[model samples]
Target: MPRSHPNSVTIPVGVVVRRTPGVTRWAKYAWTVTDILPGAAPADWKVLRSEGDVTEYHAATLPLTLYVPDAEAYAHELQARIPSIYTVLRPNAESGGVPWSVALVTASPYEAQDYCDSAEELVEKLPMPHGLHALIVEFVDKHYEEEAFVKRRRKNARVDQTDDGIGDARIRQTTDVYRAPRRREVAN
Candidate 1:
């Protein structure tokens, strides 16, 4: 059974963005965030820290976590922003390659604003659909971390000997049900 958490909700999110011509080759490759897993975003969902000479966008599709009552409304707004040709994205589920709108809101408003600004710049530079200026920001809570909480199984061997008979009889067996310890980072 899947473990449930009180603070976490899982939902699909649509990360939609228009592609531009003459953009960096990297930028061209990065527009699939709406279609692919981690599409254009980073693995951790933190604004990808830039590397020297790397073309990382200031505003990329960010994964948002939603817990408020109005999250569904927000998702609808995001859904409205997407083109009909594109479908919303569900984790591990392909909506015919269409990016789906998510119900999550921005965890960081500042990040959203930065993304908007960068998207605006790209919109201005590219000859895209009219009024397609800002990128769409959608949130969904249905996404789960792809990493499992437990590790793979392994076997262990053990032997038991009778003390009363000076090891006259012994038993040996192998079992594999060990689980690794979960590590927690301490807050300073």
Candidate 2:
């Protein structure tokens, strides 16, 4: 069973959502959130500016839990162009509306791999705030240890040629499946 680091912290973060009109090759009109706002407040989403079909919303403020075991992974994630907090979104079961149920993922890659395989869930990467980055770095420096990668050598197989191939006439037979035909034979 997998375990989470005992020293895990939950921090509150805001998500920004934008509803934009998109046209497919089939000329189908679809409304999708093209931009995500991170570290946004609930009030921000409420007062979003809407011009025509383009609307911006501050979606929700939710708790992002960071585990100590994933500190190293977080450190690696910080190196990305946009070091982000990953959010998992799914359709709201009760609302029957466009709004989605959101979850902030702070797990390491090893732990989060299971969630990646879900087709129905939408995974969004929101840029991490400077302050949050500092905090995560501090946690990682204190707890994260770089694991040494050692390559294992394959075991050598014991060869007993006399028993397996030398005495057997079938082994020496030039079967069509195992042997290439001579070029001269092919030309003839």
Candidate 3:
């Protein structure tokens, strides 16, 4: 059975989104968030910068929930050259501008894979802050345990040597129907 951390910690992280005119023919605009703000207050999509048509915003504040059960996964994330927290996003139907909704902030690769598999959403990787990395390492050192992987052997099946009813009966019965008639060779 899987274990859960009774006292899980939730850290507030601000998401910064950069919205620019789409270069592709299929899309009119591109939306992406790659910078995380630690200890940021909750806010809706508030414009941070605007030049010409390109704009950047402090999109939203999302909670990065860390659990003891997921400490191993977190440790793996931290080992990366640039550890990232993934956020899942999708276009809002009601607004022409992109809105913050259904964003998932997580450190686990397994959890990130779930968002990556979705067709209707986009997964953005933001670099994890240095302070947050230290916090995760401390949690991992306390609770993370390396699990041993076991390979299971398949059961052997007994071989039947008897020829009676060995072949497919349907194919045998239909052979004559599908076979063409043999031609006789005429001597010249």
Most accurate candidate by TM-score: 3
Error (Å) of candidate 2 at residue 144 is 0.6
TM-score per candidate, in order?
A: 0.22, 0.64, 0.73
For candidate 1, lDDT tens digit of each residue in 6-112? 65444333244432333576433323332322224333233333454343322334443344343444344444543221222233245443222232223333323
Q: What is the C-alpha lDDT of each candidate?
A: 0.34, 0.62, 0.79
RMSD of each: 19.6, 5.7, 6.7
Q: Is candidate 1 or candidate 3 better by TM-score?
A: 3
Best by lDDT: 3
Residue 113 of candidate 2: its Cα lDDT? Answer: 54
Which has the higher lDDT value, candidate number 2 or candidate number 3?
Answer: 3
What total of clashing residue pairs does each candidate reach? 20, 2, 0
Off by more than 4 A, model 3: 1-5, 99-102, 148-188
Using TM-score as the measure, what is the rank order of every candidate, best first? 3, 2, 1
